[model samples]
Target: MNGAFSLLIPVYRGDDPAHFAKAFSSSVGEQTVKPAQVVLVQDGPVGDVLAAAIDHAVESSPVPVTRHRIEDNVGLARALDVGLTLCEHEIVARMDADDISLPERFARQLPVVEGGVDLVGTGMFEFLDDGGAIVARRVPRTGHDEISRYARFHDPFSHPTVMYRRSAVQRAGGYQPLGLMEDYWLFARMIDAGASVENIPDPLVMYRVGAGAYARRGGQAQWRSELELQRALRRIRFTSRWEYVRNVSVRGVYRFVPEGVRKIAYRRLIAKG
Candidate 1:
């Protein structure tokens, strides 16, 4: 809990190898304010090739690098649970295996963390498939009051594009296994626990989207998670059944749209750069 920042990577072995290295170079490598520790935790079962890759990447990392390999595939939530426990710095920033963070991602974030804000997220440019190129640049904004007011509605920040204080996360009881989209659960819980949250207007990272994300979350599993989302929504305020359906329908359209047209629509209507 002493470093200016620590970058945590929770991997399940599906991330692009080059993307991992690029994340470090763009984020940890180029930052004027350096993170004290950069730890990569393999949440899934480690194999020979995966272990070798992580180790090789760590060897040349800009910041002090560390590695932890899980014995089994315990899902991403469990990976985060263990990762949070192992965070040994004051500021903890999350880095997805495939996404590339900007050079100033942490430097810009750390300066604004004063006062009682427990966490901060930033806008992102989507570095998705060739079809879309990039989607709308997303900039999330939710303060403590706004977060509490709309806890039942939607998530305020993109999960991976965030930096959190370790002490605050620990005080809030840490992360739990929330199935596939674990950050969704943690952010909801953080709001419930009275933590202040917000997102910087600047686009600080490149978030990747792909076809499989649609496939996995769209079918029955997404429906089940919708139930979970509804359940979480209920904890904040009572929404009518119609409200539930209406919200789900909107969320569904974004996912259910044909990928081809959807990509074009996103680029023209939303993609900033």
Candidate 2:
């Protein structure tokens, strides 16, 4: 395959490497236009099982696989910043360790990136853990204007389903170490920086949402991050002051509320969207 894009994935010890290997195997082995390389960032030390899985994936990959190892876990944002620098291609596609990229993902994304879009993301089919059952389908706003408008309240692009121009991201100062909202943070900044961003109106990835996903969203750290993100958006003029306050008031309550309530809210509001 003569694709000019590279797949960048960051893996940490907490991830199930066996499951990751399955995703990696499918992404590389089944892509309509294979990537120039697969840059896998090892964020920290992993167990023998995870290590073995990585080794097996590297050995079996159809495209060249490069591994960048960090001794300590520095989180996803920082890991991706490092991974972005190691990407050999100008266009980089982000993938989560356990998410499956559809076979036509690259083929569909390439033309858009090559056509001058700085960032391109697609809709996703969210599945329960192990991906046996369908949970929900997320069809993000497709046009730049629609995405920019929706981004005021919610993330307009799915992180794992995004393909971004490396230079555009670097010009936007790369990824910031924002807790749960790193991708949102970067995308907001990119929009502020005048980057051309769009979303394909197709589900290009299968996202794995585990049972504890909603529970993980509630907590003080995530709350603080959400507030910070809102403030940043307001500062960048992405959202008005009133919108910022409204977002913080509603999302803040959701963060501090009981996990059960948060889960229900997430299911009703977020998952159903």
Candidate 3:
């Protein structure tokens, strides 16, 4: 594919400097199809080490890397919104600071985008923070109809593996300020606005997961975000009352359970790949 795309990554204070560097190296430097530009958003003031890491990555990048800084941590949704504006191309790919995108990620997704797919996402492998073996795979539905049907109960696309049209996203109102579920909410809007979407079942990215990753998925804050997402889905008529109840009863309960139980349920029930 000859179409150019920009890679958008948001770095926060909590992100590991080493992981960020490696993520950039893999997603941009080692990609089979390189991005035309890399837009790095400093969500807040990173420490000296992280700042140096960012500088090193930008200086060493094969493609032009643009850095945008936020005085305070405004979270991923807002940071990505800002980064999207700085993208010079119509096609934009999202990457996380700690995830490893396979070499052929762009080579695989870009062609789908060029074929008139407004948004494309792929499956991912979950690896531990110490860089151990791939533990599990999270695969989403690939067909558009299946994706829309699946979105009512679960996020059908892995957020970090998504490459989407800039115009389609903006027309769908860009990224809204939602904790935990911003990507899902934005995608719901995009689908409602009639953007063509698809997911490829290839594990294109290696997602980093710490020991505390499962625990992080629980807690009151996450539960609140889950409730907000369910309400939003209902408001958009994306889900009927029965679907909303099903989501709340099942997904909401998962958020309030013990960390160990949640991990088991996730691996067995949700991330069954």
Candidate 4:
């Protein structure tokens, strides 16, 4: 109801301890409009060092911290599916363990949430290393109509920069374990379920990228995932036959392309420098 919201962050064994600390500090410790609670989800067993970092971050957080641990590592989508249940507020803000949430992220997003938008997401800057120079800015469509139109082709929201109402997410069937296409699939369903969504074009989170991010993005596994996603979209009536064909033709080939070529396509065609 009010601007109060819960910050949800999922951590896994693969996360860097140092990066997690910085992420926590930026998302919770230094927020201009603080969250009422922080829901930290440990997807699986982490190293002792990482566990200690989590403890330290929790102890240092300004708001009440609640942690949930899963017995096995279930990947991001499932982790978030479980994490969403632990959130205690109507509004929930998502943050990644390796990304930096700008100081005004909450200040800029909470008002939109309070104003009755079911979900709101913002653009993000991608960087290679810890707080390094930005390489690209991925900005999504800002209005509801544009977002709905864009969702037919690609994800209209940046996952880490989203703040959404819990009820709306649940009403849309929550998150599914859909490999790399989880966020895209979930958002499409949410839109179909009639959830009002909007995106702020300004970059609010600094997304961290690995050296091999582009190279790792494409492969047989990703190709299969993309194919399944397109089919799911068609099955759900989110994409017409023609749209599905177009998506498969365009997005599917990118998955199996050479690393250098894929990188060029992503940087030059998808992301804005």
Report the Cα RMSD per candidate: 3.3, 1.9, 1.1, 1.1
Pairs that clash in candidate 1: 1-88
* lDDT by residue (tens digit), candidate 4, 1-273: 767889999999999999999899999878888999999999989999999999999887889999999999989999898989999899999999999999999999988988989999998899889449888998778789989998999888889999999999999999997868899999999999999999988899999998889877898888889999999999999999999999999998888889999988887655776
lDDT value, candidate 4, whole model = 0.91
Kindly report which residue pairs in candidate 3 clash with one another: none
lDDT of each: 0.71, 0.87, 0.92, 0.91
Of the two candidates 2 and 4, the one with more favorable lDDT, higher being better, is: 4
User: Can you tell me which runs of candidate 1 are displaced by over 4 Å?
Assistant: 1-3, 47-49, 129-133, 212-217, 235-273
* Higher-TM-score candidate of 1 and 2: 2
TM-score of each: 0.84, 0.94, 0.97, 0.97
State the TM-score for model 3.
0.97
Summarize candidate 1's per-residue lDDT along 1-273 as a digit string, tens digits.
Answer: 233677888877676666666666666777777778887788766556656667777887767877777888887877777877777777889988778787788878886665456898898887665654865687555566765555455666777788888777777667766545567667776766767787787898888777664355455566667667766556554455766777677665655667565566555533455
* Model 1 lDDT at residue 31: 72
Using TM-score as the measure, name the better of candidate 2 and candidate 4: 4
Q: Candidate 2 has which clashing residue pairs, if any?
A: none
